[model samples]
Target: MASCAQKLLEIIYNRRSIRKYHRKPIPDDVLKAILEAGRQAPSARNLQPYCFIIVRDQELKKRLIFSEWNRFIEEAPVVIVGCGDSRAKWAVVDVAIALQNMVIAAEALGLGTCWIGHFIEEEVKKLLRIPEHIKVVAMITLGYPAEKPGPRPKKSLEELIRYETYE
Candidate 1:
C-alpha cells in the first residue's frame, strides 16, 4: 500500500482541470467517495454552510455549459454544483475548501475533475433552483478523462514565494 504522504503527493501532482471526458457514467461508489471528501473539508469557523447538487441529466448539463469556463459540463456524466448559504458570512470560503477537497479526492480515485469558475450570481441560482439565500460559487465536471492533458506549466518556487517580505 502507498504511504499517506505518497498518496497525497500523487493527488496533488496528477490532478488537473480535465476539460474532456469519456461518455461513461461514474460508478456510484466512486461518486460517493468524492462527495464524502467534500463533506469532510474544513470550513471557516466550521460553519459548513455549503450544499452540493449532483447533476447527471444531459439536458441540465447542457444548460449549465453557458457559464464561463464550463463547456465540459455538457459532456461529463456528473457535474457537482457547489452552493453557498448567503445567510452565513463564511459561506464562500467554506464552499471553496469543500471544492478543493472534492477535486483531490477525485484524482485519488482515478477520476478527473474540472473546476468551472465565473460566479454569475443570478444565472446559477436559477439553473439549479437555488433559493435566494444560497449563492452558487462554482461548478465541477467529473468523469474519466477522454484525453490525457500534459502537466500545466508553473512558475518556479522562487518566483512565486518570498522569503520574508516583498523587496
Candidate 2:
C-alpha cells in the first residue's frame, strides 16, 4: 500500500476542474466531511473570517448562472459559495485556502470540483442574501465526475522554478 503522503500527492496530481458530473447526490456524511476539511484550514491569526453558502436547491443553482462558461454550475449537485468578512485583513486569502482544502478533500473521496470565478457579485448577494459586510471570494461546484479528463499542459520545473534568486 502507498504511504499517506504518497496517496495525498496522487490525489493532488490527479485532481482536475471537472465540468461534467453524474446526476447523483452526495451523501450527507460525505458532504459534511468535505465541509469539515474546509473548516479546518489555517487562517491568518486564526481569525478564520470565512463562511460557506451551500447551494443545493435546483432553482437557486439555476439562478446563480452568470455566464456561458459556467453553465455547468447548475449541473453540479452542490455549489459552495466562499465568502469572507470585509473587515478581516486577510479574508480573501484565508477563504481561498479554505476552499482549496475542500477541493482536495472532495477529490480524495472520489468526487470532483470546479472553481467558478466568474459571477456578478451584486446578483449573487441579492440571490443568496449575503450580508453587505461580507464579500464573495469564489464559488466551487462539487459532484461525482462523469468524465475523467487527462492533465492539461503545464510549465516544467526548469521553466517555472529559479534557483535561490532570479538570475
Candidate 3:
C-alpha cells in the first residue's frame, strides 16, 4: 500500500480541470465522502463559515448558465456552489480551501471536477435564493470524466517559491 504522502501526491499530480463528463452520476456514498473532505478543511478561527449548495436538478443546472463557456456545467452530473459569509474576513479564502479539498477528494475517488469561477453573483443568488449576507465564492462541476486530459504546464518550484523576502 502507498504511504499517505505518496497517495496525496498521486492525487494532486493527476488532477485536471475536467470540463467534459460522462453521463453517469456519482454514487451517493462517494459524494458524501467528497463533501466530508470539504467539511474538514481548516478555517480562520475555526469558524468554517462556508456552505455548499449541491445542484442535481437538471432544470436548475440549465438555468445556472451565465456564459457560453460555462455551458459544460449543466452537462456535469453535479454542481456545487461554494458560498461564504460576507462578514467573515477570511470567508473567501476559507471557502476556496474547502472547495479545493473537495476537488482533491473527488479526484482521489475517480471523479473529475472543474472550478467554475465565472458567474453573475446576483443571478446565482436569485436562482438559488441565497441570502444577502452570504457571497458566492465559487462553483465546481463534478462527474465521471469523458476525456483524459494531459497535465497542463506549471512553473517550476524554483520559479514559484521564494526563500525569505522579495529581493
Return the top candidate by lDDT: 2
Question: Candidate 2 lDDT, tens digit per residue, 1-167?
Answer: 66998999999999999999997999999999999999999999999998999999999999888989888988899999999998999999999999999999999999999998999999999999999999999999999999899998999999999999999
- Please give the CA lDDT of all the candidate structures: 0.87, 0.96, 0.95
Candidate 2 lDDT score at position 62? 93
**Model 3 alpha-carbon miss at residue 100, Å:** 0.4
Once superposed on the true structure, which residue ranges of model 1 sit more than 4 Å away at CA?
A: 67-69
| Model 3 C-alpha lDDT per residue in residues 15-132, reported as the tens digit of each score | 9999999989899999999999999999999999989999999999988888899989988999999999989999999999999999999999999999999998999999999999
- For all predicted structures, in order, the TM-scores are 0.91, 0.96, 0.96
Candidate 3 regions off by >4 Å?
none
Q: Candidate 3: worst 10 consecutive residues by lDDT?
A: 158-167
Candidate 1 residues 57-167, lDDT tens each? 998888876655667778899999999998888898899899999999998888899888855668777877899888898888899998888899999998999987798
* True lDDT of residue 154, candidate 1: 90
The segments of candidate 2 whose C-alpha lies over 4 angstroms from its true place after superposition are none
- Evaluated at residue 33, the lDDT of candidate 1 is 94
